[model samples]
Target chain A: MSVNVIEAGGLGKRYGGTWALRDCSLAIPAGHVAALVGPNGAGKSTLLNLAAGLAEPSAGGVTVLGGRPAGSRAAADGIAFVAQDTPLYKNLPVADMLHLTRNLNRRFDQAYAQGRLAELGIPLKRKAGKLSGGQQAQLALTLALARRPRLLLLDEPVAMLDPVARHDFMAAVLTAMADDGVSVVLSSHALAELERVADYLVLLSRGRVQVAGEVEDLLASHRMLTGPAADAGRYAERPVVHLQRGEAQAHLLVRATPHDPVPPGWEAHPVGLEELALAYLREPGAGALPGPARGRSTQTSEVTR
Target chain B: MDIDKEIRTEGRPGGGDGETAPAGRTGAGSPVEFRLDAASGVPTYLQLVHQVEHALRLGYLKPGDQLPKVRDVVAALAINPNTVLKAYKELETKGLTAGRPGQGTFIQATLSQVTLPELAGLRRSLLGWLASAEAAGLDEDGMVALFSSALRDFFNRRGGSAGGRGTAGGETEGVA
Candidate 1:
């Protein structure tokens, strides 16, 4: 049986009585490239931070590779995280950075680290602060990869890179994943790029997991149905994620089993990843709070504040 | 290994239509590069499958043609390896291709082509009919609608016996 690389059960993180991520429970299988997508302030970074063991959750728990995060030495050894800014010692030379990584992690692959730098034409004597944005991102990825972690979590790693740099970085990541079988969970706003690389998707909205599952399965399950504007309660068999009304028709995004025949007078069409993600993010109260969270839904209620 | 090297060197320089060096190139193992259109509504894996099927129907690929390695496709497209694997698996399920351990994927079945002797005559007649429709001030969309409706009526009149033939036109004609 394939083990889940990361499992969060009712994971919640709060700051000053405001929950950043609440009741976000999802399981990502090992060796899968999972994409964490949401609008800004959707608590994407908070979830990644919790998974990376950088911050403690205010409520509930999360486990990485069968061990609680940020708790045991074994757990630390199994994970590598590259933050959004690709933080590095600004004054340290590239070679010194490599040395620092080797000294810090026992499993650091020195030859691989140096070889990748040389391959990318990154000079060893140059200071980390002087490198280009793309170069810095590559260096950060190389550091994470050299550690040979079983799971890698990256937050917005490509948000700042150019198109070419993004492509090159993703190529390197894919090659590394193929070579080492490292499972990756990356948060990004680039939907098109994510659709290409990610097999699993986790969509967050208002600090909750709006949708989480395999990409193909998700695409197959949810469909866009257009028909006369009428009550949506008739389709109680399927979960309606979003509903929009037009002058003479209503558009609904519902999750249903593949091959299930569409209801009469309703036109069903397949939904793309971009369209699906946007629908969930745009529609307020589309995914109503689960019964248990009704009393604690104050954070999401203050949308404008 | 030698075959892979030959494909890498010769296939890249040959452009899309180079037919030079026909040895080990005519059968199911002929190398064909796959491409993806991100903007297209069709899923990426379905696009790959359609391209292979199109190549087969066009005789660019034949029984025994070897497909590009999954790693090669992943590196070239910057796509998830699972996507490539899924496309290959879909093709396998359709009995169009099969995987051989360490030997890559090979085309297992040939797509049937329209080899009717009277096809040229039928094409000429259809072109004549299209010209008449144009003369009648029918736009492209109108002509398509009329022709598709007529074709559907023709099939329906045939007692719909051809329903399960896997004909592309028959499947799409019912959508409207």
Candidate 2:
């Protein structure tokens, strides 16, 4: 089996007395665009920070780039973390930003960076602080990509951009993946955008890993069932992730395959990625996750070609 | 390769995508450009696959025609490269396209499509119906509502006979 880009075994992080991410475990295999999604304060950033070696785990272990210790040199070389607010020297010209990044990293493609900035029409002399917020985000991403990290981690990279700017940013990220084969793990609360790029999904809720698997598998394993409200409780034997009670009918997100029998009077519909994630996000107690380690082991082949 | 030119038009100054600008491209102009419908609820990759089939069925893409490079599509649509790859792979699996080493993916076979005469005939009939629809004070939304209902009713009654045809026509009047 190929290396999992990230493997977290009982990982947790605490900020003082409160646990930001606890008992979290997931395996994101290489080559797929993995999206880490959750509500605010749901440990989305915490998990990413742990993976990027920016924070020491409060408890348990997290490894990146195929079992390399999170802070190890090998792992650092292969990973680039673009934090929520991409940090750069505000006073530095765009050109100096390139040079500064080049000096800090063991590897930097100066020509690639310069050419890209030129294509974007970003004047090299403009201070990083003078650029628009969207341009600043783009500049940060370019700098990260210039490093050519094997696994790129983005933390809420587009939460602040307008729709067009968001599209442009993601377009750059996608083109990079096509041109460089860079594996990406990006965290975002925006559900609509991820549907296009993210094949692998890791959903966190309230400091725990709620759902982790390939989006396709997760979607296929879950279905929405609609039927009379009175009959909803009778399906207690079935694993229902979220139940919505309507005036006379109830909708249930069940953990079942397409071939699973739909009880009399209930309609079964295939779930979409957004709908499934929302359902799981709404119901924290109804987890679709298996034992993390064993669950991800059988699914390692899904990512690598 | 086609990415640099497109990105330059964004008006937002450049960000590096690490895609080298390949000069002196000799391939003929591409035949189809892809667009996405966010409200359509169709998966992006499936939309791409459907677009390719549409181009094929419309004769815009013929055998040996090259599909857009993955990088170009990513730059154009702001979608995942893997999504494009998946669409191409699906096309390849169905024998509709084949990938040549170092060259872009090419159409391998043509999809069955309507002949010009048939298309013209269908167009005439549809235009005639549309004229009637407009004459009846059915605006665009009204026409859409009526058409979608009729279309749904028609499919709901499929596997039955033309018994469905009369009611579908009858239901169109209700919208008016």
Candidate 3:
């Protein structure tokens, strides 16, 4: 089994004089729907583009499908990327799109692709441009899966679709993962939706790595401590990722395990993926790089500078 | 957990589109389908584990019945396959289900249950309690809150984790 689908070290990319992503390093394990999340311009798309071999990094290095260089032929053969908006030829018929993709990839499943489209009720002869937004996204995803790659990178794949379409799109992704063992790394602004589907999470902010780890580890290691606002500062010496102050109560998202003693008059509640992610995003200066905690299931993340 | 809301018997979204049919099968087919309540404070895997236990408690699932395939559950629920596998692992750990290599997961045991007569007796008592609570001016939400707190207190009294789902710290403990 491939240990790490994508691994990077001091990975960075510069456009003109500005760095889109800088000093980035993380390991996305072989078997997960890893969520790459952050605000717009947080380098999510930049990182994905670099990993998909669409662009070269100006500094450091990255690899895909085990140790293969990101843009190498071996890596290209085992990876498929559907970028933002999934640019399908607007004028091409759906069947022609599939035909084009099949001819482009070395390992294309034409029959599987055809069967799935028919099941989705997408007419083979309809132009992609004429299809509904959901249908278009589905078409792109179907095309990607038809390649049967070992790893699939999707950038904002569901941001444009409606709730139902988003759900349908994720179901397709899940099916592909389960049946084909394809590892997925998708970036999105939809935290709630990702919570349901993603087992791993990588949070980026202002061109730097902020939080990265298995969703469960991040949730377990941190907690929402609600207490009197006045006493919140007393716990600042601890690893406080973010602190939200209310009129009377203060909620501090801190790095604490279950065995950690809860302070007097404070209630410690388990942090959630959405809650933790948003908190860290709100506190851009906060950095919880992956220390590769001892009990973490697999070290799918790394230290970030 | 609103376990049955928007449940699609078809494993895949397009399962009913002449290629695969999920609702047509009976006894030998998957006895339970999963529903995800993202709004529910429960974790995805725990929601699944709770659903299976719930199915067992209600006699909807039983010994020898097949749990839905991981592929089917993930397809229908649009969740990661690992989450499904984790729930199944939790069930296996609880001695409630077993995976038979080539076959799907099967219910290996049943939750200890209340008999029909006992259930009727309990329902009658609960209805009586509800009538009194109604007399006491408790609204539906109030009644639910009161019942939940009392149930939690009951479990807390036994010194066991509430809901017997101590798998994670995702859930908060209700005060007695």
Candidate 4:
């Protein structure tokens, strides 16, 4: 049976008067690598934290694998979270870290964990603090994989690693997914890297889910329309995500039906994941209604030409 | 497998050029490798599909050739395994490839081929046409645009003639 690895409903979290995440509803399907993407302070981390049970939502609720996150020992056991910095006991030897994981987790796979570290050529005797950034990331992944958790939540695990280390870490994650059928929700700002590794996407902007769905389905439904600048009223029926006006032309990203024909004089082009994410991220007034019929005045001033 | 035999006879080594060849085990007789370009604007699965189609068109991949395993592809490209499966499934839908239960996906049909003599004649004419376009002050982009426009017009004209009888009169067909 299919189940969402992570499901949120009107999920919100606030610190004092500032809201980190607000009104977010997302369901990430199991067994698919889902990318949680957004700019800095876009609440990407907060959402992941809620799912990991590291933080409680100020309003609404989120479930990981149909159970409240961190609500019970069993629920917590099903999730393995690798934080952005991949925090580990710095002074402990790599082998000791593995030993600690094996001791702490009920389902740790010792052979798998040791084998991965060995294959990566990381010495068991080296202290975690002494290891290179890439080695540390790999070790973090190794510990997570060894837990054999049903869901893995990684927050920018490779954001600090070099390109080669990043590639290696992602490769290890893919291998684990292939072998264990683990559901992964990786949060990152690296759209290009995510494009290669993630099949499912959840784009967050300003503490809101701008868009979320299977990558292929999202790409197929959204289109970039370029034509003469005019009032958006003519395309009122369509869900226009963002609109940018040039000197004499306007470019629009719209969630269009498959059979919906592009309006005359407008050229429709398929947009990539990065382009689609950027369009929504750059859109002003988070969760604002589609622009009015004021032709040029409605044009957003943020997008230059 | 006439195409498979033909590919073997072409004297192309076990692996084609390094860039296109997938770093995986080549099937018993047919050697076919796959690669992905993540930087391209094209979707990753579509890129795989296009690469396989291009390989088939160039006689590098044949009916019996085996595609790289899903794990191998995911490991090599650092992509999700589902993306590879999706690409293989798309190839299956197009009747270009099929998967065996335990073995990897194998090519199911060969791309249409042109006779060597006909291809030679067409290549020579194309070269001449390219020269003429260059002499006419057409840059690479201009030449491509002109050629594509001409090709589209040619196909649309044929399509209109074939289907225009039932269509509304005086209506203009849209360019795809």
Which residue window of length 10 is worst by lDDT in model 3 chain A?
A296-305
Stretches off by above 4 angstroms in model 3 are A291-305, B1-28, B116-121, B132-138, B141-176
* Cα lDDT for residue B26, candidate 1: 22
**Per-residue CA lDDT of candidate 2, range A132-226, in tens?**
98899889998999998999999999888876678789888888888988999999877877887788898888998788878777876777999
TM-score of chain B of each: 0.61, 0.59, 0.65, 0.67
Q: Lowest-scoring 10 consecutive residues by lDDT in candidate 4 chain A?
A: A290-299
Candidate 2 CAPRI level: acceptable
Error of 3 at A38 (Å): 1.3
TM-score winner among the candidates? Answer: 3
Candidate 2: what lDDT? 0.79
User: Candidate 2, A104: how far from true, in Å?
Assistant: 0.8
Judging by TM-score, tell me the better candidate of 1 and 3: 3
For model 2, the interface Cα RMSD in angstroms equals: 6.7
Which of the CAPRI classes, incorrect, acceptable, medium or high, describes model 1?
acceptable
Q: Which is the better candidate, 1 or 3, if ranked by lDDT?
A: 3
Alpha carbon lDDT of each predicted model: 0.76, 0.79, 0.81, 0.75
Name the runs in model 1 displaced over 4 angstroms: A230-238, A288-305, B1-30, B112-176
* lDDT by residue for model 3 (B1-176), tens: 22122334444453322322232222236866666656667898998898788777656776778998888888777789999999999998877887989888888676635555676788899999999999999998999999999988898898867446423221132112
Order the candidate numbers by TM-score, best to worst.
3, 2, 4, 1
Each prediction's DockQ?
A: 0.25, 0.31, 0.42, 0.33
